[model samples]
Target: MEHDLPPVLSLDIGGTKLAAGVVTFDGLIHGWQITPTRREEGPRPVLARLFDLGRKAVAEAGLPEVAAVGISCGGPLDTATGVLECPPHLPGWIDVPVGPMASEAFGVPYALENDATAAALGEFRYGAGRGTSTMLYLTISTGVGGGSVIGGRLHRGAAGNGGELGHVMVRPGGRRCSCGRLGCLEAYASGTSIAERAREALAAGRASSLSAVELPTAEDVSLAAAAGDPLATEIWDETTWALGSALTDLVNAFEPELVVLGGGVTRSGAMLLDPVRAAVARDAMPPAARAARIEPARLGAGVGVVGAGAVAHDLLLSGKSDA
Candidate 1:
């Protein structure tokens, strides 16, 4: 899978940002642009701008040739069909044929992968899971999402969306989720959920330093927790509890050798990961727990781009080997 010398164009689509870059085999991003998605203007214009960004990234990288275009986005997106099936985070986006469009637009072969899945690959290829045969990557951001690699292969399911690890029920009938369910892992563990929980606590007249602020973020809560604010501590404890509980389930089910955590919420770093790791160790079935090692994603903000590029590279390499 080593490109050795060439770089691929990598694009990542998020609810808030549109990012594109040229990623080399060594996990370096040559020219990266982070732009607002402006999704309200709909998919067409956004895609046009995204394509333009890819072109700019290619030019800025000074690469002699572009091998391929790799794209990553949220799911339940169909990687096989290259169609986005109305991901809740992406409002008004319905069945957009991103792969074909990007292929045609870039005049090079293109590949699409779910953000979390690509992230798992990125981690496996260049991050915390470099030496592991089985790994899991979880992103706790606006929502909880994840993907896995098993036996050195991406564990994409029949519909290419197997690991909806975030949707797993953490507290049934608790908070409503973007997937229209209640008490999902996303509801309890996501940064949005963390902020909402804090806001609700404040609205309910909880005594805390956060009450001084008109609007508080998850980062504020984490900082408050670090400073020993009781209410913030309670919220942080619950966030860790839910993640630990759900991770116990994932560890038991997947038995991966390592678990890589990313996304905005992960900025809490050891504060967030430590408890989850302890929980899985204490709660998961014995053999599985013994097999898993929880850690941070090494790729940082470049994961999505590198991940998509990794997916494209793997697919292209597989095709070459097959032929």
Candidate 2:
């Protein structure tokens, strides 16, 4: 059935970039293209460019025609209605009819999904999570976002935003989250938060290698911590602690077989993975800890494109879209 499915055009809309590719059922991407988002230009022009990029991808892939188009972006969104509802990353983009617009552009059926939820499906079907029935995926990038696959199916909670794992409370009444909540995981564990914390520390006159950099980022903090900078180490340690604490709770609650960590910040590799793994092993219930194997995502920078493609494939297989 998978072999018979036609290739689909996949589009990923992010705060910083836009990517497009034609993805086959085998999860191989072709004619991949990318460009800066320039989000300040607002939704209309950005969407126009996205559509053009999709056309270019289709033309370059040299396929007869795509079966469908899949769009993946940050949420809160209405999957059933194909509308984006004020996603934080895309400011001033409210109630955008993306699904129908994409359908009109490509003249094919379209399926829209939350970016993290789509990435979870991508990993489950084609990447690190293959063959696992229950898995959790966390993207620790500009903002922390997550999704899960339970019993081999994507779990898009009643809100259709997956579980919003990033919003899990880690430190009650601590740092404020973008979601207006205090001490949510995103407030402490996200790349944005990591950089912000380091900058705050430097601003308070704490001395460290980070002081040399004009604008220290999460990567800078990780590097400084690895080199034994005390301030950076403290910040890095706290970052891992928050992630570990939240993951321990999730592991106990979901009892997943795998936990995949993806996104830019995860590029620190062992620096991030080692401590998080150790914490889960030490704090989570024995059974849950033993069952969950924490690993890095394998799809790399193209995950969003692949994930969007996976969503389109599912849409076709479901027979809900005439494409």
Q: Indicate which candidate wins on lDDT.
A: 2
Q: Residue pairs in steric clash, candidate 2? A: none
Q: lDDT of candidate 1 vs native?
A: 0.88
Candidate 2 segments whose C-alpha is farther than 4 A from its true place: 1-3
lDDT per residue as tens, model 1, 121-189: 898988999988989899988888899999999989888975888988899888998888998899998
lDDT, candidate 2, equals 0.95
Cα-based lDDT for every prediction: 0.88, 0.95
The reply for model 1, stretches above 4 Å from the true place, is 1-5, 320-323
TM-score of 1: 0.96
Q: In model 2, what lDDT does residue 113 have?
A: 97
